[model samples]
Target: MPSPMVSIINVSKRFGALQALDEVSLEIPRGAVQCIIGPSGSGKSTLLRCINQLEPTDSGAIFLEDELLGFERKGDKLLELSEGQIAGQRMKTGTVFQRFNLFQHMTARENIVEGPLRVLNRPRGEVMDEAVALLERVGLADKSGAYPAELSGGQQQRVAIARALAMRPKLLLFDEPTSALDPELVGEVLAVMHDLASTGMTMIVVTHELAFARDAASNVVFMDRGRIVEQGLPTTILTEPTEQRTRDFIGAER
Candidate 1:
């Protein structure tokens, strides 16, 4: 098999008394839609955060393509990347939160273009062109002129997706993409994600929807209490889980 696009080796993170992650290791190949399902606070979210370096890992190494997301360096080490360097690396992996994090002050188009213009330092005409195309892809072509306040929750989140896509990220990280939507509006947001997945996009999704996991995911990772208890093909993990913890968790949800 070819090498994984992202490699997480011996990763661990702790906060005071709590050990959020414990010697976690995962390999995510390119263009794979991996769904991480677990009870809340089971380290699923923390593992995602660690992959993008959103949360610092006390001991671990994460590799993303040519650069290392987190490198071990200390104790007379010649050089280690500074915080700003790590933040820049983190930006390459776009994140969509449970809450649509669109800026209230900017219009939809503006919000989509903000990161590219400021972070990537692309030319205005080029960035605007890319943003408009992305907005259209996410079904928000007509809403570009509207501000966050003008759009509904679903529309806003779609815009948020466009904003993340506008960066042309190598990987998309979604933390409960549809959790904030109204029950009636969740379908629209999920539809957009399904469309993205169809195009073979590399994505890591944290979701509670079992059907989405079984149908949409290329693989399912079942996590519990700061460790990955089980991971396998969706069919295997969902229907033939080996670990009691994985089966019990899925059983309770059903």
Candidate 2:
């Protein structure tokens, strides 16, 4: 494939006495859906945070395009960037979380447009139009006039997806996006994600939805104890996982 959109090299993160990640290295190709799954505290979320520079690693490097995301190594030609520099790069990526994180005071339309209007300094008409279009895409066109309190858990998460899409980001990262939804509502959110996958947008996800990961992701990564246990085509890893740990993990989940 062309040079990966995101590259991680010998990356590690430590929290006090605990090592959250250990020499993790991977290349994420452009326009593909990739998911990382493991038990809790397996460094899944930390790895996600490190990618967007939300958390600084103790060692190793991340590259988004030509720019180093964070993590400086000694004697490595130090092209370290400032927070503003990184934020500019980060705007090219959008994130949606398990928690909706919507603005209680604003309507759904306003919540979606607030970031673009303030951060990108976009024009009101353009922002509004984009917000409406995104809402329609997420199946929340009618919910635009409502506030978070007026919507169900699934609806709020859909609005959050619309809010993220409003930025017109080059990549989208989902962190356990359906973990907070009710069982009945999870399918709706997953359906939206499946539709997104069909569009071939580059996406990286940390999710527990194994079936969704198998069906929607082109690649699946199994992470454990701060390391990648296995990475391969979803079909192989999901149906015929090679590692004993992979089989054990899936069995425990089942």
Candidate 3:
């Protein structure tokens, strides 16, 4: 059997007195879209952070394509990787934040090409061509020369999505990606995401957009108090969840 794209085994994280994640375990298959939904402070975003190694787990382990993340096993000991190594691993997963975090001074094209050019050291012409294609993929080909400040909220967020794609990441992590946009603008960003989903990109989205969850996600996970309350097919979990916590949360979302 092919290995799962991402595996979280008994992972836990703490922030002082607050437990951000508690023995969370999940397996995400390749080319699957998993939507994580819950109330605020439920550790949905924290889980994404841990998966990307932006935040460390206090216990347990996370693996991408069967390779341990953030550490290497040597004999009986597990050694943490160097910063450079960690950065390399992180490049495999791309994250889009709630707020569009594009570089203010850079044009959309520049933002998309920066990582491929500077970090991966790819050929300049190749990266530029890919950047143009990525911008077109996100429905912003004409906006490539525009700076973030000159674009609408949805356009900037689309640029952010293109930037993430430019790296050709194995997985995409979206944390409340449309939360900062106006209601009218939200559909544009979600539309782009829907297209990505159709292409079988592995994505884990932390979002309150239940419609997207219902339509785009292969599975839906509901979390509360740093623990997974329930997880199953989106049709089941979103419509007929067995757990009271899951039902309550889904009820509140609508």
Candidate 4:
């Protein structure tokens, strides 16, 4: 079998007195969508952050496409890479947060173009073309010239998705992609995500949207108190979870 697209091994993270992640290990194969669901402070978001080294793992390691991320392995020793090297490895994973963290001063088109031009150092003309195409893909072609102030919460989030996509990341991490949107606006953003998933993008989503998780996820993981309670195919996990915590959590959500 081909290697998993993302391999996280015995990962643990702590913040002073509180442990955020506890001996977590997971493997996401290429083109798979894994949805992580649980209550607040379950460390779902922290796990996503660790994947890209946004929050460093206190122990263990994360890899992308067989490459050791954020560190180099010499025999049994793992040495942290330089900031420059870490930044390069991080580019392989794109992240979309609960908040649409856009630059208020830049237009949607400019926001989408900024990364490829500044980080990737692609030619301006090529980046502009790709940015425009991405805007169209996200159903925001008309809003390309619009500033963040002029867009709805859903629209801005869609633009954020487009911006992340412009980087052509190997893996996408979404942390509650719809949590901040108004109820009426959530579907639009979810629709874009559904379409993206259909196209076989490798994604790891942290969300509470059970319907989306059931409909679009290849696998579902139930996490609580910084540990995975259970995980399996979405149908099995959602319909017939064996763990009492998983069943109770799903029941409470319902």
Candidate 5:
């Protein structure tokens, strides 16, 4: 078997009295799509945040490829990296949030190229071309000149996806990418993601879309109450879940 591209080892996190993640461990391979599915407040989003280091883990470790994320081992201690260092590490992973966090004033093309120009310091001409290509990839080439307010919810989210791709991340994290979309617009967004999966883009998606998981995911993870209750091949987890909680969740959704 190939080595994992991302690993979470004994990861636990807390916010006040709530344990957002409890000793969760997962290995995500390169060129694989892993979908995390569960009810609300099940720590699905928290886990994604931890992977991107948006949420500092209370214990355990996360690794991307061979490198530790967010912290550095020094002698016998694990010390948090400086803000600058963390930013450098975070550049390898791109996250699309539940809310389409696009800049209201910037056009789609500008939003897509902002990161490369500001953080990577690439030539504007080069970044702009790549940005346009990314917009095209997300099926929004004609909407490149539109600002956030000028686009539909689905269109804005597609632009957000394009902005993340502009970074050329090794791993892409999607947190309920279509949750805010109109029912009619959801398919277009999922189609783009399905296309990405088909092209072997390594992705970890937190979604309620079982059809997407069933058809696109290489693995399905069923999480509840900040812990993984059951996980396996999508066919098994979605069709023949071993745990009652998984069955209940799927049953309720259906």
Candidate 6:
């Protein structure tokens, strides 16, 4: 059998007195849309950050395509990667956060082209052309010339998605992507995400949008207090979870 695209092995992270993650382990298959649901301070965002290597893990390890992330093994010792090496490893995954995090001075097209042009050192013309196509993919082709400040919350988020895609990452991670948007604007961003899922992009989304999870996700994972309560098919996990904690959390969410 082919190995899973992402293998998280007994991963643990702590923030001073707080145990942010408690030996969390998961396997994400390629082309799967996985939704992680939990309450506030449940370590959902922290987990995403760990996957992206934005936060250094306290213990255990994460592997992407069977290669260790954030560390290299020399002899028996596991040495943490330098900042430059970590940046190279991080390019394999794209992350979209609650905030759009765009450059205010740059237009949407410029924002999308920056990574490939600067970091990967791809040709400017080629990257720009790809940027145009990515903008169209996210339904923002017409807004490519607009600045983030000029766009609505939904539109800006769409651009953010496009920017992430420009890097051609193997995995995409989202942390409460729609939490910052107004209620009415949430659908537009979710619509883009749904379209991406249809294209078989390997995505791990941390969200409270149960409707989206039920309709688009292949698997749903419920977590609480730094541990996974349960995980299974959306129909099973969302509709008839086994754990009492999962049931209680689902009840509160509904």
Regions of candidate 2 where Cα sits further than 4 Å from its true position: 71-80
Return the lDDT, model 2, position 27: 86
Q: Please, what is the whole-model Cα lDDT of each candidate in the order they appear?
A: 0.87, 0.87, 0.94, 0.93, 0.94, 0.93
lDDT string for model 3 (167-222, tens) is 99999999999999899999999999999999999999999999999999999999
Instruction: Put down candidate 5 lDDT per residue, 1-254, tens digits, no spaces.
Output: 76688999999999999999999999999998999999999999999999999989999999999999999999988999999999999999989988989999899999999999999999999998898789889988899899999999999989998898899999999999998889999999999899989988899999999999999999999999999999999999999999999999999998
Global local distance difference test of model 1: 0.87
lDDT of model 6, residue 222: 91
Clashing pairs in 3: none
- Model 4: how large is the Cα RMSD against the reference? 0.9
Model 1 pairs in collision: none
Among all windows of 10 consecutive residues in model 3, the one with the lowest summed lDDT is: 71-80
| lDDT tens readout by residue for model 2, 1-254 | 46787888999999988889999998888888989999898898899888887888777888876667753445856556688877887788888887978889999999899889998999999888888889999998888899899999999988888888888887888999999999999998988889888887888999999999888888999999999999999888877999999899888887
Give the C-alpha lDDT of model 5: 0.94
For candidate 2, which ten residues in a row score worst on lDDT?
A: 70-79
RMSD of each: 1.9, 1.7, 0.9, 0.9, 0.9, 0.9
**Given candidate 3, what's the lDDT at residue 157?**
93
Question: Mind giving the per-residue lDDT tens digits that candidate 1 earns over 45-164?
Answer: 898888887787787777886567756456745245788887788777988888888999999999999999998899999999888899889888899899999998999999998999
Candidate 3 ranges beyond 4 A from true positions: none
TM-score of 6: 0.98
| Model 6 lDDT, residue 75, Cα | 100
What would the TM-scores of all predictions be?
Answer: 0.94, 0.95, 0.98, 0.98, 0.98, 0.98
TM-score of 5: 0.98
